[model samples]
Target: MSDLFSAAADELAAASAPLADRLRPRSLDEVVGQEHLLGPGRPMRVLVESDKLSSVVLWGPPGTGKTTLARLIAGASSAHLEARSAVTSTVKDVREVLAGAQARLGERGRRTILFLDEVHRFNKAQQDALLPAVETGLVILIGATTENPGFSVNSALLSRSVLFRLEPLSDEALVALARRGLVAEGLFSGGDGTTEEGPDAAAKAEFEEALEVLAVAATGDGRHLLTTLEVAISLARSRHGTGVSGEQIVLGIPDVEGAMGAKAVRYGVD
Candidate 1:
């Protein structure tokens, strides 16, 4: 009945959410990789820690942490964040956010951070509509895009914002992330890739080896790595029956390969 369906949906929601979001770093300290921008004494880190951020554009390939960085900045900033996706937002939406930003600044002496995901999706006119607010600092723009802003964003709008490039997660970083993920899921006991001593030793060893292989296969895409890991976990659960999960489950190279090959899962943390 409706009650049964609702219960099923509630159970599946967390399992189905994009891995990047479910395992999202809660604080700047929890974030891995991107040391160049977030390392000690880095200008961006300094600015964010002090909450003195200005209009900036985050440019990077998918799964490189553009959205994550924007959200963190918004949390740390002195401004109110008004997030939107250019893929779904029209000029009217942009105008509304700008108006809210203006009113907020005028009435309460506050600033606003407009974090636009896929800002490159905005057409010339739509991009232009954001210019006045950005230029005048009524809204601190934090535009996230996979495309090059120089080509996709309006020249006028692009010039007003500081551009920060995010690099893809390196293999080492991805491996570290994989280990962290296993720990988070309770598949591994600790960050050292050690099991909790109750799981089968052979199975644990095989799973660890498979994790390395999968990490390399992920090829610098953290979202892909994490999402595929979730799928592999599900496969292990099914293969061994749901009674055994997390630490006691049996997963190996075959599970990873099966998850990768079964279907194309486009869901991710971008």
Candidate 2:
């Protein structure tokens, strides 16, 4: 990792852990959800690979990995990423991020990606603040919202950006993702731990049951799903007075509570 990214990751690890962070996709290939938009030979892949993508609006319900996708793009494009929250950011804040974009463009001839989370929360005035900058190509806007953009965004702003709808992850996808996360953390038996160098059938079955319950509760939201998995991992490590069983694993109180209290928003990209 670059020095700046390493520092940022360290800070996040030290600070309050957000659901997005817990569930954050390690890479594009590992992304748990949004296959419709990001699967092989998809339009989004074409646009992103072309490196000339226009501003886009990611419309979806909560937990669909909107923030994760934005982060992935920012990392891949080498763009100066500026994130703003429609819930808390004023027009002035938007302007400041826009200014950063302008400066980065001038200095590096690189594109700037402004990821707006909960974009539906922005009223007319706030969205208006983005007009001039967007019109002039100072930044590429990536807006995410749980609500419908037509109801939240101004027509002009909506018109300027391409809209990409992200679907909730399927149950199979969520199950696959949980196993992958466990593998990534070396919780599975494929490396150094108690078992052989691969996930055993029993472990796989345990994860399958746990993931099914999580997926159903998460309601297709990859963020919530992953956060639950993270909580389970910590619980397993701590040996917190209880053991995981098929019944206890699924709908575990700890995982459910952790997912609920987690910082649902990280940088307004979700």
Candidate 3:
């Protein structure tokens, strides 16, 4: 019976994994942070609602969900989504993407959203190659960069795309995301403390603490927080004979100490 239960638990966790990850939010409301972008009357909100997104730039530090937001924008639009990473893509890749966009336009009469991740990594020559496509509506460029685009991106290409700055996620928002992750995974099955008993007080508290510290360490980057939380949860479950007990969870002092030492100030807009 113990072996059977263990196997069942493992299967459940495995099955739950994809759904939990996928539930990461397709819509802006589903997104945990970045309220500034999703908030009413915001330019991003208007674009998403109107499906009128154009060539753009997403600027922020690593793990701040730039890639995710860019993808979401592409998904939200009727335009074709084409992605290229500056670190690996060459002028040839740019030309190919442009060609594909042109082909799609001719075949389906669809627009294109060209997402250039780590755009700041591209040299002047690469940026210059994209100017014609971006300017002529052959491609709607969505550039993402960990560095400052103004310093690295060509002035002409930079002038054409609207720049959107993304900030880091806050401890509270990170914690909220973590809790949602748990609930979404069906790991904490229960009703209000009165009903099914849900997650125990100790378990909930520990998860909150772990999430808070992890988020602080992530420095407002939602992707970083999610990845770290996933790893921590996996590790904790492994230690507890795959049961995922609160005691099994790891909490780093660097994160805890950091969270404790810092003054309370919200990071991400939402």
Ranking by lDDT: 1, 3, 2
Tens digit per residue, CA lDDT, model 3, 42-128: 888789789987788988887667877888888889998888889999999998998888999999999889888889889888999
Worst 10 residues of 2 by lDDT: 261-270
lDDT score for candidate 2 against the true structure = 0.71
Q: What is the C-alpha RMSD of each candidate to the true structure, in Å?
A: 5.9, 7.8, 7.6
Per-candidate local distance difference test: 0.81, 0.71, 0.72
TM-scores for all candidates: the values are 0.85, 0.75, 0.77
Q: Which rank order by TM-score, best down to worst?
A: 1, 3, 2
> Per-residue lDDT for 145-201 in model 1, tens only?
999999999999989988999888887788788777766666753355665555566
Please, what are the lDDT tens digits per residue for candidate 2 over residues 1-270? Answer: 599999998887855665446546667777776767788988777677667768889888887778878877777776778887888999889888887788788888977889998888988889899988888788888999888888878899999999999887798777666665665455652223325343356654544455566666677877666777777766655543356332222223344335456423221122
Candidate 1 clash total? 0
User: Candidate 1 or 2, higher TM-score?
Assistant: 1
RMSD (Cα, Å) of model 1: 5.9
Candidate number with the higher lDDT (2 or 3): 3
